[model samples]
Target: MNTVFVVGSLNIDQTIRVPSFPRAGETIRGSDATFSPGGKGANQAVAASRAGAAVRLVGRVGQDAHGAAILQVLAESNIDSSHVKLTDSASTGTAVIAVDDQGENQIILSPGANAALSFADVDAGLATLTPNDVLVLQLEIPRDIVRHAARAAKLCGAFVILNAAPSPLEIEGLFDDIDLLVVNEQEIQDLARLANASGDLAELTETLPSVLGPAVLCTAGAQGAVTFLGRRPVHISAPEVSVADTTAAGDTFVGYLAASLAADRELPAAMAIAGRAASIAVTRPGAVESIPWRHELPTLQDHDTQSAALFLSHP
Candidate 1:
């Protein structure tokens, strides 16, 4: 089986359920506070492992309770953490998230140990990769490290998937070495500088492929996703479900997509499977904890472009 390698961050998310987000410098009362294992890299690694992939996660964590806790969490999800390092210099990455009644969220992040990850760290991780494996990466770590990992993975003939998050200033050069680039609406709009987009939804779909290259998959929450594979777009909509927390929906989608691809599934088929997996994820709470296993998706039909488009548009 093809191994799925995730080179990214591991964070402990502190979430609060509030009536609404607080305005600048305003303190608002929240109902509850919860701590969960999060971080885009760790979330994706956990999700992929839960979805039956041979997953490996490479990142740094603090030598503290949060980092120790994350190791146990990843082990429970069946993810290989042999390369997950623990450093005493910094705390593990932390995120403060506020969720509203409608399931919308606002988040603030501290890179922490995630920022200390260096190219040398990734290079050591890459030493374990072989051809035909899938390498999944995110922007939560250093940008130069991400670029180096992509370059090295491409040279080794591994499929490189870059999930562009927390939007960077430029993305054109970044796409040249990537086999796939996944982005949410807001990320695409900001990275591509789509002026005509009235909102996150429009901005991404309209200008994502232009600056981010042709092999782009843009995720629209509830609305499903759209993929441009050097041709006309393939749109897939998600099934509607009562959302509890959308913290790791996109990460789940990416993880499932990587799993499916590693299993030799084609693009459309993989994406259909991924979308269904993600739909189930949003209906629950927590990040990695919400991802479903591959065997649980019996109800999802395989590769229905039309139905997928509907899910992308409506749910």
Candidate 2:
């Protein structure tokens, strides 16, 4: 199986449940705090491994208990964390999240060690990719590093999946060789605008694929996702499930999508696997904790005869 190299952030997430999001400058009472291993990088790595992908996590953490706890979570998920660096330069990254009763979340992140990721680390990670592997990245770390890594991965002939979350203002050159671009509704708009693509979801979606030459997936919570699979649009509805916390839903989707692709499944089948896994994720709390195990997913017999690996590179 192709390996999924997850290059991104590692964070200790602190979740507080409340009746609703607090108004600015308002001190609101909430439920007891819950801490878990999170960060988009870590969450996606966990999600990929749980979905049966051989995974490698490349990122940094501080020399602290929070970091150790996160490393333990990676080990528990069977993710290879050998490339994960431990530094005293800063405390482990942390995210303070508030999940309202409606399963909506708002997050505040302190980059900490995540901000310290350097080109050297990117080089070390790049050295591990092969044409048959997958390189997964996010914007949690420096945008420059994300851009650098994507470029290097392309040269190495690896398939790249960029989840443009918490979308940045100028993506500039992040899509140079990206095979798949995943984004939520807000991210899709931000990306389209950055690329100067105009129109509604359908029009916006088409314009991106034409410009970047990548399959675009725009995830719409509860309403499902709109994907440009096989150079056309396909809307996959998310299975309706009772909501708990929607923290890791998108991460779960991205991870599963990569895993399925690495397994040589077609895009439509991969999206189905991803959408179902994400539905299960939203019915739980915490980020990594919210992602479901592969065994927990229903058998996708309909996709059992996937034609080919639609988005993978081979040496």
Candidate 3:
């Protein structure tokens, strides 16, 4: 199978459970805080590795305990963390998250070393990518670096997939090199508006093939996802599951999707695995811990979309 390179962030997720979101200037009692390995880039890398892809993570972390923990998790998964550097320029990135009884969450990010990742530190590693490999990215890192990596990866003929989570103010510039664009409900609207594209979700999905030059997948929470993989748009349903935390559900989906595509699976098949993986993620807790493994997915071997309903509905 081809390799998957994840150029993203490393962070310590500090989460607390609250009865509900606090109002402006309001103080409320919350459950004891729990710390875990997180960061969109790191989470996606772990998910890809767990899904059976050989993953190499390229990012930065502070020379601190949080960084150590992040590295430990990568090693546990047998992911190549050599590209991840320990920088003293800033502390490790951190996220303060609060989840409610409904599994909805709000997060506040403090980008430290994550903001310090420079292309120079990862240039040599990125240069090793082959045309058959895949490069995955997110918005947690610098936009310029994300663009730079995308351009380089595209030029090498490698597949480039971007998960536009935590959508930025402008996304038109980043589309020049992306092979696949994955976004959620909010991100799709933000990106469409920023790109000066006037259309609803269906309209945008229909138009994105011409805009991004490849495929687009827009996830709709538990309802499933809408995909336009160079074909007409298809709405795929996610299996029913209990949601305990929505923290890294999107990241999990992106990771599995990238792995499937890199393995040369059909677009519909790739979309199916991603949705199924994300569905399983919602039923668990934690970020990295919540993602399902390849073995956990009973239908992982089904590469045709014809039987996707059978594979997804049963789980």
Candidate 4:
């Protein structure tokens, strides 16, 4: 089995259910507040482990209750947390989230110890990686550390998957180090803007492989996802389901995708599994709580063959 090393952030999320999003300088009363283990890296690591991958998470936390809670969640999920370091000077990373009844949410993040993660920390964690392993990364950590990890993983001959979330950052030479780039509609737009590539979805998708890499998966919620492989595009429709909370939906997708790929599944097959996992995630509430286990996933009939055919035909 291929191991997955996640070098990213671990945050304690403070979530509140609100009637609607608050406007500028407007205070709105909310329902009872809840705390959950979150952060893109932690959520994705849990998702990957539950999806049947050997996963290890490398990040930083504070010497506080919130940090302990984050480690507890990882331990319960059976993910390796030995690389998660505790700092005395900083508090654990925190995210204040407000979710409306409709499941839309707004978040404010305080990086805290997550920002304190150094390249040395990442290097020590990555030392366990073999060429067959996969390195999963997100933008929640410092850009320099992300760049270093990506470079080191590439040098080690491990496949690197980068989830460019939140937004695009000006990280030099980062794109060249990525094996697979995953992004949502908004993220793709942000990437296109950063790369100065213009056009509609099709045009942009067709142009991305030449600029970003050989593979770029651009997801459009409800509308489905488009896979760009070396100028070829394959469209995969998302499974229709009622959404309860969208928290960690994207993380679930990325996690399942990495798990499937690490298990030697082809890109198309991996993407189908990921899409299904994400479809199931949004039907539940909370972050890690919303992700589905491998046993819980329904078999997709002919999905692999059909998706592969689409991919090949496009090429």
Candidate 5:
């Protein structure tokens, strides 16, 4: 099995359930507060591990109780935390999330130690990577560090998957060497704006090849996901589930996608598997705690034999 190295953020999400999102400058009384171990990196790491991927996390936390609690959560999830560094200068990364009855969420993040991630941190954290491993990154940290990690992973002959999350302005020239680029609808819009793309999603798809050389996975929440391979596009619909929280849905998708690829599954099949896992994720609350384990994915297990037969026939 290929090892997955995740270099990103670690945050303690303080979530509150509210009647609705408050208007700007308006303070509405919240229902309840819950603290959960989250952050893109930690969520992805937990998701990957739950999906049966051997994942190693590389991130930083503060020398505080919140940081310790986050580490304990990761440990409970069976993720290796040897590379998780603790700093005395900063507090642990934190997020303030407001969730509504419809399972919608709005987040405000305080980067804390996540903002302190440097290239040296990545270099040291990923020292064990080899040619056959996978390097997963997100924009939760600095772009320069993401670039540095990508370069190192490429040099080591590892597959690079960049999840352009929290959106960015410009990411040109960075995706050329990336094996897969995962982005949500808002992120796609952000990229389209950066590349000066006009009109609708079709124009964005048309401009993908010229802008980013790697294959793109566009996640459209409840609508499902679309994968672009050159001029070919494969669409997969998400399964039905009563969503309780949509916080970790995208991270779950990315984790399962990487796990499927690591298992050498084809793109279309992998997308279906990832979509199912994500559907399951949104039905639960919290980020890492919501992701399903590999054995728990019955939809995937039932179709495994069919997929094998199809693969044999096609090849």
Candidate 6:
């Protein structure tokens, strides 16, 4: 099996359940605080591993209790953390999250040690990837380092998969190195603005690959995801489920997609599996805690097989 290498951030998520999001300058009381191992990089790495992929995570954390706890969680998830760097200069990255009864969440991030992940770390991480391996990345770390890692992965003949989270104003040369670009609805709008293109989801989905890469996966919560493979857009419907917490839904999708691809599943099958896994994720709480294991997923035997076949046939 091809390995999934994640070059991204590791954060200790401090979450609280609230009646609703606090207004600006308003002090709102909430439920007791809870801590979890999260961050786009760690979440996706854990998700991929849980989805039955061999995942290696590369990033930085402080030499603090939070860092140790994060490492322990990764170990428990069966992710290789050997490349994870521990720094004394800064504390572990953190996200302050507030989730309401409606499962909507508001987050504030403090990069901390995550901002310190250097190109050297990226180089070491990319060294482990071989041709056909999946190299996953996010924007939580330094954009320059992300660019360098993407370029390096491309040079090594690895498949570069970038989840353009917290989308930036100018990606510059990074798009050239990405083989698969994953984005949510808001992220697609941000990218569209950056490219000076139409903000319409369908138009962006159709035209993004021409400017960005060969494929773009645009995820619209509840509405499912649309994958622009060349000029054709393949839509995958997300299963309907009551959402408990949506913190890790996107990460779960990205992770399962990478895992399915690494396992050599076709794009349609991979999307179906990923969508199902993400549907399961939103029904639970926390980041890594919410991601479903491979055994926990429903067997997509007859019905989903036909659906995937039909989608592929049409596209």
- Superposed by TM-score, candidate 2 places the C-alpha of residue 141 at a distance from the truth, in angstroms, of 0.5
Clashing pairs in 5: none
For each candidate, C-alpha RMSD in Å?
Answer: 2.7, 5.1, 3.4, 2.8, 4.7, 3.0
Candidate whose lDDT is highest: 6
Number of residue pairs clashing in candidate 5, backbone atoms closer than 3 angstroms, sequence gap of 3 or more or interchain: 0
Residues 69-90 of candidate 4: C-alpha lDDT, one tens digit per residue = 9999999999999999999989
Local distance difference test scores for all models: 0.82, 0.86, 0.85, 0.86, 0.81, 0.88
CA error at residue 243 for candidate 3, angstroms: 0.8
Clashing pairs in 3: none
Q: What are the per-residue Cα lDDT tens digits for candidate 6 across 133-178? A: 9999999999998889888988989888999997887967878899
Number of the top TM-score candidate: 6
For residues 201-290, write the lDDT of model 3, one tens digit per residue: 666766866765656777878657776545455666777788899999999999998888788887787778888888888888888888
Off by over 4 Å in 1: 194-210, 307-315
Q: For all candidates, what are the clash counts?
A: 10, 0, 0, 0, 0, 0
lDDT, candidate 3, equals 0.85
**Which tens-of-lDDT digit does each residue in 270-297 have in candidate 1?**
8888888888888787777788888877
Instruction: Write down the TM-score of every candidate.
Output: 0.91, 0.93, 0.93, 0.94, 0.92, 0.94
- Candidate 4: which stretches are off by over 4 Å? 303-315
Error of 2 at 276 (Å): 0.6
For residues 48-89, write the lDDT of model 5, one tens digit per residue. 888888889999999998899989988987888888999988
